[model samples]
Target chain A: MTGREPIIDIRNVSMRFDDTLVLDDISLSIANGEFLTFLGPSGCGKTTLLRLLAGFESPTSGDIFINGQRMNDVPPHRREVNTVFQSYALFPHMTVFENVAFGLRRKKLPASEIKGRVAEMLALVKLEGLGGRRPAQLSGGQQQRVALARAVVNRPLVLLLDEPLSALDFKLRTQMQMELKHLQRRLGITFVFVTHDQAEAFAMSDRVAVMSSGHITQRGTPQEIYENPQNLFVASFVGEINILDAVITGHAPDHLEATIEGRRGALHSRRDYPDGQRVKVLLRPEDLRLSRPEDPEAAEACFSGVIKECTYKGATVDIQVEIEGGKALQATEFFNEDSEDIDYRPGEPVRVSWVRGWETVLPDD
Target chain B: MIRIVKAAYVSLVYAFLYVPILVLVVFAFNDSRVATNWQGFSLRWFAKLFGNETLLGAAVNSVLVGVLAATLATAIGTLAAVAIYRYRFLGRKVLSTAVYILTIQPDIVMGISLLVLFMAVRMPLGFTTLLLAHVTFCIPFVTITVLGRLKGFDTHIVEAAQDLGASEYEIFLRIILPMILPAVAAGWLLSFTLSLDDVMVSFFVTGPSFEILPLKIYAMVKLGVKPEVNALSAILLVLTFCIVFAAQLMMKERREK
Candidate 1:
């Protein structure tokens, strides 16, 4: 995705509603033909950013550029962008065909071309032969497909989707996630998706921008974000993370020496840190390994504690181990087909360790 | 015994409501000039009603006022309701509350106030004044009807239209108007009916030169109850029932869609 021209550019944009600032100074660039997602919780300004791009709102300050054209003064109808609202916002009085054909009609396309394009778009969404039904007569999933087809039929330069799949059940949501990803690939257009669910963002987006408090906390691929989070908020928001207190005592040529949970170990980091500086070590639950205290591998373990609880999750068991100094850490262990070692009883003694370089180290804030 | 009591109770309520209208409808076909005795079954009064030029002229005048007032009120009221629902301007809350208050105000008070306004303005009391008074009172009913329909509307649909390349005027014409057509039609019908048979407001504003159906009927009844008046009342009653029935059917269709 490097060296590609950006389709949308937001420069030093800030939005204020009355006395409260909804979005602080922020800037972002989305490359052409790339799928990018804005992932955040509610009131995090993800939807506000998407609205700014769609021309439904104007920033209190700063300029927006789409295809190198200033869009701050352009009204929504004249902009070459479209949106799929969270509620699906299908015109209730119109049939599926008319709703899908609305944009084409507005562009003054001929009748025959509008009919052909609407049929092709509906077919892409797997809603063929159901064009004559009103929105009220269709199921929720069907209405969602109509909304998608309606926006994409015009082939806008950019498509803005605001939590477009949050209304579906688990099975349908996952299925639509795959379909949306595939649709973006087939269309070859830039897609800017906004969602609060991290898993949903990772499933469909090529790059995810994690947002908090109206700020873009981190931006990277899903693997980069998970393995090397820039801050504690980004680390905890992307997935389940266990934070352990660590203090840097000294530095070696390759790795730093830290006192972690009353045990001294070599911590791998690329950034330089001063001696005796306080830091926090972050680890994913799935990376932690568990074994019995008397096992030979226990010699390399970091801490020994009694198992507090075990939850069976069909494919894996989540174990809560109370380490030294009353700190509880969660470790997820997968079950092998031929072994029953994952089945552990409460109050059983266990040894917890992980690969030395797998942890992410960040300064305490 | 309980069934008999329930039946009697239902019959009493129905008779109390419909007995007067039934009497008028029955006497419309009487051959005799006096309304008390039924000489024979004939359409004599209806025939006389058609030949009487004064009654016909008054009927025409009432319809002209009703159509003009209802059309103007529907246009103004629909715009007012949309503004109240969509914008966040200053005094919006006060304006909405004022609309509700007008809907519940007494007709006699409105009539007197309108008469005083016309007199103060030095406007002559004729068709123009009558039309203005009818339009003034009919606007609140139209606004209330349209606003009731707008309360359940989802505003996101407007945004969706704009996102799909619809201008403001296009959105209103193609999306909002079509969706709220049933309510708009019902409001127009209601205003028309109210203007057609309004007696109190018409009494204050209308001059002697421009006689309307209701005031003319009142004057005739003051002398004695005639068969011609009964025949005219029956016709007006049937016309009102048809309007109400049509409005209800439009509402049901909207709900079904």
Candidate 2:
């Protein structure tokens, strides 16, 4: 991801709408042919950043570069970028063929060439024989494909997808996610996708930028963000997390000795903390292992808790545990077909512990 | 018993609306000049209507004004609707509200005001004044109609076009115009109908040299209700019906598409 000139560079970009700032000062770069996603809840400026890249909205401050050329003043039509809007935004008056051919016609390409290219694109999107149908005649997923084919048919330097699959049902959305990722790879075009769905972002993005309150809080690979969040917001937003209060008592060679939930435990951390420093420990739900309190191995380095409830998910069971100090934690255990002991009743006493060095420690925010 | 009452009420309403026009249509085919007595079915009044130079001239003038006023009003109003919908500027809200106000303004008040405006400018109250007055009244109707159509429009479609390398002009021409054409056509037809049948506004603004069909028919009826007048009224009614029918068909086709 280094040494190659970035296809897109957004430097110190800020956007304000009257009294509200939509995007704070932010800088990001995308490599050519790389798929990056801006993932956040609504009004987090993820869509605003995508719009800036598409040249629909200019930044109130700072500059945006596409293919090394500044795009602050350029109109969307002049810029080498295309967008698949959330609503699909297919032209209702035109057939699927004409909708895909719109940009090529705008470029004043020869009519025969336009026809052939449109047919090829239609075939690529698997809508070959349906080109004559109008947008209203097609189903939702077909409309989504038409939108995708329309934007990518232009073969622009950057393709911006503003939650293009959000309108689809769950199954279709999942299928489109895979198809979109494959299309991006096949076309070798830089894709800047915007969505609030963490799973969708993780599934398709080479890098994910988690945003909140108009600021990008963290940007990294999916595993990096899920396993190691920078703050509480990123930790809870990306996935389910168990945050526990811990007070550092001493430092070891590579780990810290801390009192967690009124129990002594080893805190694995990359950063150093002074003695008696207070911090928070982050753990994924699946990392916590639950055992019967009477078990000898569970007697040490564990927090005693009562099983509050058990939710039987198809692939896993979610166990809600109330720690002795009134802190509730969630633990997800995969379904074990051979074991009947996985079933736990409410009010049952249990001890919760995790593997050493599986926790992320951060200063309280 | 309830069904009978419902049918009677519906029939009564239709009769109340159409009885007068039905009388005129029936009289158009009357053999005698006397409107009260329908001697027999005849094409005599229809032939006389075509041969009367005064009525024919007025009919030509009315058609001319209707076409010209409708075209000009539609062009101006459609552009105004697009501007009000797409761009934000000072007084945009005020301008849109003003369009609605004009739509509800009484024709007599508009006619008198336009008359005063022409007098103040010392412009002759003839074809030019009549055309201007017709366009003025028709513009608000056109704008309101197009705006109604624009209410359901998706603005992201415009952005999508721009993202696909379409310029502002191309987006409007290729995307916006085609999408809103049914409304624009409806507005134009409405303007033409309004201009063709107008009596109050045209009464104040038009000069004696430029007589229109409605005013001419009014004058003819003042002397007496003649069979030729009935024939002319029936023809005008049919023309309006055809225009309205065409507009309905266009709107229905767009909806189905």
Candidate 3:
């Protein structure tokens, strides 16, 4: 993996279907053996981008180089890429063994080799003895495993999975996610997965490209994306965010005083914002706290507000506070001895705030 | 309230539609030479019908023409239906309209036009001519039946097969063919039934050298009502029911499986 060049290099690629511009000019480089995910909502062209990489569609005005060779006119059959579709797209007419053997047979590989490889793939996907059954005979998860084995038996340079786990139930999807991640690790081939599920994308990908409406909003490690999202879309898309519009009241060398709910505070940031500019601050639910206004010396912008709602979710508590400035701030706190006794019922006024710079201050919407 | 009304309407319409056929079927089993009154029930006319050599030969000719027509029509129509359904090309709308015209054309007009064209071209009017005309009439039936099924076909499955390294021909042969085969078989059987029972097209396209069962029955009806004719109609009815029922069973099994 270290010695080889990047497995796929997409340079300024754009695709359009008649009047619809499916994918805009985009460039991305994917390293070999890296688990990369294309994360986006519907109509984001993630599937189209995957098809372009698999040589199923031609990029309108750019180059797609696989293993350092430009592949534009090459058909999908000639390309070293296999796709596992969202529908699993299993051949309903063929048995599991036949479906997996289809590619090897196309290459005219020896019969012995074909059988051996299919058996090995089926075993890898943990469907070892189920090869003789048709797709309809198996459950959804089992059929999905067959689809994966069918695609991987070809030994593609990169495996393209288009929301392959979307159809499975929650428990099975979670189990398969772990299995797929491990399989990729063992195979050490570039795995470019596509899904709109944020948790699944974050769980499986080493880095993810979050696309919206045919353009990538942000591309980064899951941690980087969740912690330091570049803009409003990435911040809201990657995770649950409690956004607040705060005006800077004063600025210091290492901190700034801002008013969030008619409450002033010095926001200590390792970054900087102007003294008077209106900025939106993003606080992860867990980063917020509920306490009295007496702890102002140690706290940042403490809002004197009423606890309008409290949802007891076994391990953690979700509380919605009606803060000053006519805004409701949602926060989650862990169940501890202090929180257990404090029944901040509706209409009970409380100070809700967080430590300055506990969250990333995003650019204004 | 609406369901009751709809059921009543459907029953009345169906009774009106099938009253003639029911009359014919009942008369075939009456064993009486006259339709106004019933005599003793007997199987003697069925025995007598099987002994008519001229009627048997005409029955055999109609079967042969129907088989040939069904074979040719199903082959071309299924292919045309698949092509029209699967791919987009120039003049597709025009081609589709042409198919609609083929299905709706009156059999007598189609028969007369075919006769004049064949005669002007000096083509022989016999079994081959009758077969050709029947096949032309049946092509639209096959196309309509197959096209209905193809419309319900999951096209993504075909694309999936192709992506899984099956060549285009392999995809069709393995995936598309098996998926649509029951529809094709149904279409073939339907066309065969229509061609075998046809009178108008066969009337014009066939020369004196060849004759069909319907023409024979026509000639018999003109002369006098024969008990054997009713028996032959019973046999035809039974054969048609068997073919259609078997086709439907195959379809049901495919659906269940």
**Better model by DockQ, 1 or 3?**
1
Tens digit of per-residue lDDT, candidate 3, span B224-254: 8787887898789889999999888877776
User: What is the per-residue lDDT of model 1 for residues A1-365, given as tens digits with 9 covering 90 to 100?
Assistant: 33379999999999998987888888989999889999989999999999999988899998899999999989999999999999999999999999999999999999999999999999999999999999999988899999999999999999999999999999999999999999999898899999999999999998999999888999998888889999999899988899998999998988999899888887888777799888999999999988898888888888888899999998888899998778999999998989887788999998889877898999876
Candidate 2 global TM-score:
0.95
What is the per-residue lDDT of model 2 for residues B113-222, given as tens digits with 9 covering 90 to 100?
99999999999989999999999999999999888888888889989998888888898899989999999999999999999999999999999989999999899889
lDDT of 3 at A304: 74
Candidate 3: segments with Cα more than 4 A from true spot:
A1-4, A261-263, A268-275, A293-300, A337-343, B1-23, B29-31, B119-122
Off by over 4 Å in 1: A1-3, A249-266, B1-53, B87-94, B224-230
Number of the predicted model whose DockQ against the real structure is largest = 2
The estimated TM-scores of all candidates read: 0.92, 0.95, 0.92
Of 1 and 3, the candidate ranking higher by lDDT: 1
Roughly what TM-score does model 3 have, to 2 decimal places? 0.92
lDDT of candidates 1 onward, in order? 0.91, 0.92, 0.85
Worst 10 residues of 2 chain B by lDDT: B146-155
Error of 2 at B73 (Å): 1.1
